[model samples]
Target: MFSFCWPALLFLPLAAFPQNAAPDAAGGHSFSNPATAICAAWAGPATDGEKMRRFLEALTLDAYVSARHGGTGFNWRDITSLLARVERICTAEPARSLAEVWQERKTAWHRGSWKANTVRCREILAAGDCNEDAFFFGIWLYAYDQAKDGRSEATLQTLPQGGGAMVWEECERTPDARLLDVLRRMQGK
Candidate 1:
């Protein structure tokens, strides 16, 4: 018979590894919320904070599209709240500041000031030096220009929703099996 418990000893440590993983570290894990848990697992060091920020950007744009074209099915209040949730999960200083600015823009939009939204987006773009920030600015600019030409309504209705649903789906589509597995596990739980 076996004289040693080597197999059991080896398995014990491996089982403990998951629980011991760090948060925000390289290859670390986080679970800000169930929804964000999926993002955290799906968002590894490579994607981490920045990609998550982009996902928020997508959600913001989706809300705008829904509000403008979904026959008012969406609300700016909901969009601002969603952005705030994303900002909290992202936990990056820049994201926090962006969230505040976004909230202000949402307030302005509610007050019927589209120019305020445009200005806020421009300010965010100016403060950052990356595609993610630029993307939101571009999206807002596209909306602004289209609104000016009275074509945004048609575009908004045609656009698909991009909040939680879109981000999670895209995360699942990522090539990394580990990230995919983590997201799957979170979704199942």
Candidate 2:
């Protein structure tokens, strides 16, 4: 006769599961939204030009997804325009750093309560205004949501892009004041 340990069997499922499943390494759980994750990384202190480019690529995909989903209250055209402005900033003279831009924006957001930030994001989303400030704030809100959901670093390296050269070309053609300000700050001007 064989004896089975019932108590040990109860612990089997727990042992099989990851104790702290890392979102970024989830093999099969495709991120529901990658733009937010990329944006979180972009806002962090470690970002560089290459990281900015990657974040832009992920944002483009998110814009497409917003267009396809149709009920998320997202205006895809506005999102595209917003991304273009960000790209322009990245390609500017001296190249604005996303980390710096995020710090500035985060500081501004923190001047008010979280409720105020939420209200501002809602207003921007509802107004459908595509100005640089509004667009940046809106995307920042998305990134904030992703961070809150513990998906900040989940899809940084997995998002797809058509190519980097074309993005750079378009970025060279666009211009933004906020980005210019960052460049100025970096130059001590």
Candidate 3:
């Protein structure tokens, strides 16, 4: 005995409905501020790989989502390139912060001027390296068919078992493929 009016749900505002909220990442750290003094720590030796990866993923993910929701007018195509450019900026001026460099690039570069790097496969998939969390974070980014309000989330319970291994196997065969494309195909999109 179950009954409900499907038409009633359509009138509800997106905010009014419950969403599959993600738990606050990184000890409730608010990475909303771009000038949060991250380049120094990121460039320095990483003592705790997990924490470092979490923070990095969170920061970049925030930026990506912000751009997605019109926070930034032009969204950067992918995390790998965005991070690569951020790394370049960090290397050139260790004192400058992420948001500063991000803003600079926003003004300087065209939206589609650049392409995602293929060699990034090796870097993104290499776990236990200094930049270990990129793979999981990257997966989370593409986990949804549409990244909005966490409606279609890709969680551990939702993903098929051995999915990660399948990605690794595919990546091993095609080292030059786009990470997002690879992930999408593996997800059977």
Candidate 4:
């Protein structure tokens, strides 16, 4: 004779599973677009340290790709430095949302004047033996920095051809393969 309670059998599988599984089953969180994912993670509830670190690393890669697409021939040192700075800032202000902290940083820099920043960007471009790539990279970085500084969203809106805006718009529109690569490498997958 076999006696099985159907309700108990049904409940068995559910009980074996974690009651509070992470929102994202594949990972703690997942998104088709890495940039959007990073931004969302930043704005979302508190996450584990490892996850946060991975997000920062991905953000660094995204920024690097964005700059390169704009034609900046930045050295590894520069990229690493930027990553470290951003990580430090974000780490220190864990309570603040990423958007809020980013806005605050932008405001701090914008107070210095967008015109001056733009001029400085040009000077940096001119000082170097800039080729077409370098020139575009400079423009992209300038626009991105200005946008971050809260100078004007229009800078992002109307950037000239081969500028940061172009790359940014593309990133926003679709998932960047390079970004996925970076994430995969970070995850050791």
User: Estimated TM-score per prediction?
Assistant: 0.23, 0.26, 0.36, 0.27
* Predictions in order: lDDT: 0.34, 0.32, 0.41, 0.33
* Alpha carbon lDDT at 184, candidate 4: 26
Q: Rank the candidates by lDDT, best first.
A: 3, 1, 4, 2
Rank by TM-score, descending?
Answer: 3, 4, 2, 1
The C-alpha stretches of model 4 lying farther than 4 A from their native spots are: 1-25, 28-97, 105-125, 130-142, 145-189
- Per-residue C-alpha lDDT of model 3 across residues 63-172, encoded as one tens digit per residue: 44443444322223344455556666666675555555555554322233222222345544453222324433343444322333343321222344455556566767
Q: Kindly report which residue stretches of model 3 are placed more than 4 angstroms away from their true locations once superposed.
A: 1-67, 70-120, 125-133, 143-157
- Which regions of candidate 2 fall more than 4 Å away from where they truly are? 1-109, 112-117, 120-122, 125-127, 154-189
Clashes of each: 0, 0, 0, 1
Tens digit per residue, CA lDDT, model 4, 1-189: 112221222222222222231246555432222222233333333345344333323333333333323322333234334444545665555343433333333312222111222333233323343243333333334434443433422232233343333333333444333322222233244
Model 1, span 18-47: residue lDDT tens:
222136557645322211232333232324
Worst 10 residues of 2 by lDDT: 1-10
Point out the higher-scoring one by TM-score: 3 or 4.
3
For candidate 3, give the lDDT.
Answer: 0.41
Model 1 CA lDDT for position 49: 33
Angstrom error at residue 94, model 3: 34
